[model samples]
Target: MITTPEHDERMAKMTFASVYPHYLTKVEKKGRSKEELHQVIEWLTGFDDKKLQDLINEKATFETFFQQARLHPNANLITGVICGYRIEDIETPLTRQVRYLDKLVDELAKGRKMEKIIRGQ
Candidate 1:
């Protein structure tokens, strides 16, 4: 994934809060609960419910969000394509990290089990 400067900059500036509702809707429509969504988030980013809500309330950008995250050691276990880009092939660290979250959310929206979505972590 060769991200253009504009793309990366835009993504870096985009708030996690902006995307949060969409993710919530995606999973909720698939019959998943908010707690389950938060569970995956906690597994990947080490943000507990309180911290996650704080970030959302502060309107943190993607860059800020990841910077604050204590990313899971098992994060690399999250693989496959998301938004047409293969996770392993992405060279941009931030983009890959974002896609890792995307892939997890995608799996959740697709009705994948919690254990499987978080790679059994």
Candidate 2:
């Protein structure tokens, strides 16, 4: 089981740009388009395509990346187990937000419908 500190350190060291290609690869491997991935991310994080690109270009860390995000009102609707920890149970707000994005991407990669993933129902 991953401890909070371990999760925090890992997230702190991760750059959104560095992880972007991997997200694309995960979704694309399942025949999902990058546009679709972006759409889900945009719906959840409130970052449009150009702004997301700018953030990616800046090589923002997961902490900085999420700090800039204007999370959707429906974001709290996203709650479930992701990587063993319940998304709603993560104690650190920043860490929880990071895991929320990770969980959303994982759901998308697992072939979940976009609307449900975004709406969380």
lDDT of 1 by residue, 12-112 (tens): 89999999999999999999999999999999999999999999999999999999999999899888988888998888889888989999999999999
What TM value does model 2 have? 0.89
Clashing pairs in 1: none
Model 2, 1-121: lDDT tens per residue?
A: 2356887888877999998898899999998999989988898788999999998889999888888898888888888898788888777777788878888889899999887888952
lDDT, residue 52, candidate 2: 94
Candidate 1 TM-score, C-alpha based? 0.97
Provide the lDDT at 105 for model 2.
87
Q: Pick the candidate with the highest TM-score.
A: 1
Measured against the true structure, the TM-scores of the candidates, in listed sequence, are 0.97, 0.89
Model 1: worst 10 consecutive residues (lDDT sum): 1-10
